[model samples]
Target chain A: MNTDDLIDFLATRVEAVDPGRQDRLLTLAMAGSLCLAALACIFALGVRPDLLRAMGTFDFVLKVGFLAAMVAIAAHGLRRAARAGRASGKLLRLALLPLALVWFAAVMQIVATPATSGMATMFNDWFVCVLAIPLLSVIPLVVLTLVLRETAPTDLHYCGALLGLVAGGIGALAYASFCVNDAPVYVGIWYAAGLAIVTGFGWLTGPRFLKW
Target chain B: MSREPDLEALMRASQSGDAEAHRALLQHVSVRLRSYFRNRLRRSGAGTDDAEDLVQDTLLVLHTKRHTYDGSSPVLAWTYGIARYKLIDHLRLNARALRNVQIDEMDDLADVDRYEAVDTSRELHRALDTLPRHFRLPIEYVKIEGLSIAEAAARIGMTDAAVKIGIHRGMKKLAALLSEARP
Candidate 1:
C-alpha cells in the first residue's frame, strides 16, 4: 500500500497508449452519431417538400455551410480539449470564427433586405429551428459524453461546452435540409440560440458528469 | 546511465508499455509530487499526511490519464497540470467538507460535552466491524488508516474504481448502522 507497491501495481498493468487512439475514437463517434442524427431527422422530422428547390437556393446552401463549419471547428476544439495540457486560447478563438462569420452575414442580409422581409425571415421557422436543433443534439451530446469520459479533460466546463457545440452543430447540420427557413438571420439567431441552450446545459452539467 | 534522466524519452517508452520506464517515470514523478504537495499543503496549513495522500491520488490520475498526453509536449508539464488540478479539487472538496463539519458542530454545540471522542471512536470501530469484508476493508484502509484510494485498492487487490465504490457504499451502510444503534 506504500507508494512503491502502488507504482508496481500501476506499472505492471500498463496498457500501451495507442497512438492517435483518442482522435480515432472521437472521429468515429462523431461520424456515427452524426449519421444517426441525420437518420433521426429524416425519419422523425421528414425533409422539406421542396427539397430539390431548397437545395438550389443560396440561403439553404449558406445555412448548411455555416453549420458544417461550426461542426468542424468545434469538433477540432473538442479534440484538443479531450487531451491533457492541450487546451489553448487559439482553439477558442478559432471556434468563434464561424459564429462571427455567420453573424456578419446575417447583418449584411438584414441591411440589404427590407425591414418587413427581415422580420418575416427571422420568424419564418424560428420555433422549429430552436426546438429541433437541441432535440437532435441529444444523440451526439450523449455520444460525445460517453467518449469524453474515457479521455482526460482537465477543464470540465470548457470541454463540456465544446461537446455541446459540436453536438448542436451536428444537429443543426442534420436539421438544415428539413428546415424551410433558410434566411441568414434566421439561421444565425435561432441556430446560435439552440446551440447556446445545449452549450449552457453542457457547462452546467460538466462539473457533475465530467468529474474524473 | 546518463547524468540526467530524459523525462520525455522515459515517458515515451512508458507510453509504449515499457514497465521499467513506466516505473522509473512514476518514481520520479512521485518524488517530485511528494515535495510539491508537501510545500503546497504546508502553505495552506495542511498536514504532511494529506500531502502523501495527494501524491498517491495524483499518481493514480496520472496513470489513468497517461494516454491523453501528447508525445510532443513536455511530459513534466502535463503531469504537473494534472497534479495542480487534483490539488485544487482536493482543496475545494475539503472546504466543502469543512463547511459541513462546521454546520454539524453548530447543531451539536449544546451536546458537545455529552459525546466523548473515545466513545465515538469505539462506536465507529464497532460499526465498521459489523459491515461485510468488501465494505469494511475499504473503510478501514481509506478512513481508519488514512490510505489513499490507490493504496487501499492495491492493498485490497481491487481496482481503484471498485475501491471507491466500496468506500461509498460502506460509508452509507456504516451511517445506517450507527443511526440504528444511537437510539
Candidate 2:
C-alpha cells in the first residue's frame, strides 16, 4: 500500500483501541519488570555479598551491591515501560536522578570518616563511612521524588522511583567496601566526582547504548 | 529510515527480561501495525468507525499472541500477520451487513457523504515530519502511542508542563503545516 493509505489505516485503528485495555497491558508489563528487579536485588545482596565485599569493605560491599541492584531494576523497568509504549529516553533521564543521589550520599559518608594510617583506624573509618552511606542516602530518594512530581499520573514513574531508591542504596554499600581510603574530603569529592563521571557516561552512552 | 536496528542487543535484552527492550519493540512494531490496518480500511471502503474497531481488534490479538512472535523473524512482519487477519475479519463482517439489506433499502449516498471525507493520513504524517525533532518525538509518544502527558513527560525526562506545552505547540504547528498542504 502507498504510505498515505497506510497512515490513514493505522490512525483509524489506533483511535479504536480501548484505553482501559491498553492501561491494563502496560501495568502487567511493568509488574513483570518489578519482579525481575526484586530477584536481581536478592541475588546481589544475599548471594554475592562476598564478591561485593572484595571490591571494598563489608559496608562498601553492601553499597556497591545496592547500586548494582538499582541498575538491574532500572533496566527491568525500562523494558516494561517500553512495552506499555512509554518513552525510553525520558525514563533513563528520570532514572539518572536517583543514581546521582546515591552516589552523592556515598561521597558524603566517605567525607565524614577519613581513613587513617593504622589498620584499626582504616577499618573503623571504613565501617563508619559504610554505616553512614545507607543512613544518609537521600539523592536517590530526591530523584525519585522529582520523577513522581513530573510523572504524576503514571504509576510506572513511582515504580521507577522505588526501584531507583533500592538500587542506589545497594550501590552505595558496594562502593564503600572496595574504595576506602584515608581522606574524608577525598572520598566526598571523588565519590561525588565518581557519580558525576557515571552520570556523564550515562548521558553520553546511555542514549545510544541503553536503548532497549 | 534513520533509526538503527540493534537486533542482537534487543534479542539479548528480551531474553534476559529487559523491560526497556520489550517496550521499544512494542512501540516500534505498533507504528507499522497501525499503518497496515489503515491501508486495509481504505481499500475496503470502510468508514472511520470500522477502521477504528479493526485497529483495536488487531492490537488485542497481537498482545494475546505476543509469545508467538519468534525473535528470529522481523517484528514488523509478525505484527502484520495479526493485523491482516483482523482486517479480513472486518471485511467479512461488513459483507454480512450488506447482505442483510436490499439494494433499494440502502441508505442514501448523499446522507453519508460527510463520512466519505478524504483521508488525512498522508497530510498528518507530512505535517509530523515537518515538526522539529524535539516536538515530533513527544507527539509520537502522546498522539500516536496514546500515552498520557505525564507518561510522556516521564519518558522524555521533562516536566509535565514542558510536555504539555510541547504538545500544544506541536499541534498548532501541525495544523498550520497541514493547512498549507491542502488545496
Candidate 3:
C-alpha cells in the first residue's frame, strides 16, 4: 500500500481505542499507590512519639493535622499518577507540590531539635529521622519516577532529571519542618546529602525500570 | 445532566475531580478512537478483531494515565504518543511471530505482494532521503505518519503555515519521483 494508505490505516487503528478501559486501568494502577501511601502514613504516625513533649496540646494537634494533610495530598497524587500511568500532564505537574510539602515538614523537625554532644542523644534525635528519609521519601519518589518514566518523552530526560532534583528538594523541606534546632548549616549538609541520595536513586531506577 | 461539554474542558474538569467531566471526555474520545483503529486495519489488511483489541488497549492506557497529560500541550499529541508506542509494540510482536514460522514455506502470492509493497515503499523512502533533512521530516511526519498539521508543527517547532508549505513542496517532489519511475 502507498504511504497515504498506510497512514490512513494507522490512524483508523488509533481512533478505535476504547477510552473506558483507559480510565479503568488508570484507576486500578493508582489504587496500588494509594494503598502504599496509606500504609506509609500508618507507619509514620505509629513510629512518631507522643506530641506531649515536642509541642503542647494545640501545637501537637496542628502538627498532626498538617502531617495528615500531607499524607492525604500524597495519596491523591499517588492515585492520579497511577490512573494516567503518564497521560495526564496537569496531575503529574501538580503532584510535585504536595510531595514537596511532605518533605518540607520532615526537614523542619530535623533542624529544630538541638544538637547534643552526647552520641546517643544525637543518634536518637537526628540520625533516626535521617535514616527514615530514604524509606519514606523513596516511596513517593519512586512512584512519581515510575509515572514520569512511562509518560515522559525521550527529549524530556533533562526535565525528568530536574524533576528528581525537585523531589529531593521537597523531601529536604519536609525533613526541615520536624527539626527543632535552627542550624542552616546542618540542614544544608544533611538535607543535601539525603536529597543527593534520593535523586541518584531516581536517576538510576527511572531510566531502567520506569520505561513503559 | 446538561448538553455535552467540550473534550478539552472535560479533561480539565476531570483533572480537578469532576466526575461528569471524566465521563464526558471518555464518551467524546471513544468513537473517534474506534474509527481510528478501524481505518488502520482496513488499510493494513488486518481484521476488525485486531483493531478492536488495539482500541481497548489504547483506551485503557489513556484512562489510567490521564494525569500524565499536561493541559498546556495539545491533547492529541499526548494521545498520539501513547498510540504510537502501542502500535510499535504490536509490530514488534508480529515480527517475532513471523520470524518463528518457516519463511521458505510461505506462498508466492503473499510473498509477491509483500515484496511489491516493500519495494515501492523503499523507492519512496529513497526519494525522501534526497530531500534536505528539514523538509524530509515535516513531510514524513504530516503525510506519512498521519499526524495532524498542528501536531507536526509543534513537534518540529515550525509554525503551522511553514509546516504546510514544506509538506506541499515535499509532496510535489515525491510525486515527480514516483511518476518518473513509472516508465
Task: Output per-candidate TM-scores for chain A, rounded to 2 decimals.
Answer: 0.92, 0.31, 0.46
Tens-digit lDDT track for model 1 on A1-212?
36775676556535467657888999999999999999999999898899898888888888888888878888888887777666455665676777787788889987997888788656776888899999999999988888887777788888888888889889888887688888778877898899888888887888778866
lDDT of 3 by residue, A110-160 (tens): 566544432223333556455555555655565555545444342233334
lDDT of 2: 0.46
Q: What is the lDDT of residue B40 in candidate 2?
A: 71
Sort the candidates on lDDT, descending order. 1, 3, 2
What are the TM values for chain B, all candidates?
A: 0.57, 0.46, 0.49
Expressed as tens digits, the lDDT of each residue in B25-105 for candidate 1 is: 998889888989989988988666667666767776677667777775687777777777777777775675467567786
lDDT, candidate 2, at A8: 31
True contacts kept of each: 0.51, 0.00, 0.03
- Model 1, position A151, has a per-residue lDDT of 79
Candidate order by DockQ, decreasing, is 1, 3, 2
Worst 10 residues of 2 chain B by lDDT: B110-119
State the DockQ of every prediction: 0.27, 0.03, 0.05
Residue A199: error of model 3 in Å? 1.9
Cα lDDT computed for each candidate against the true fold: 0.77, 0.46, 0.50
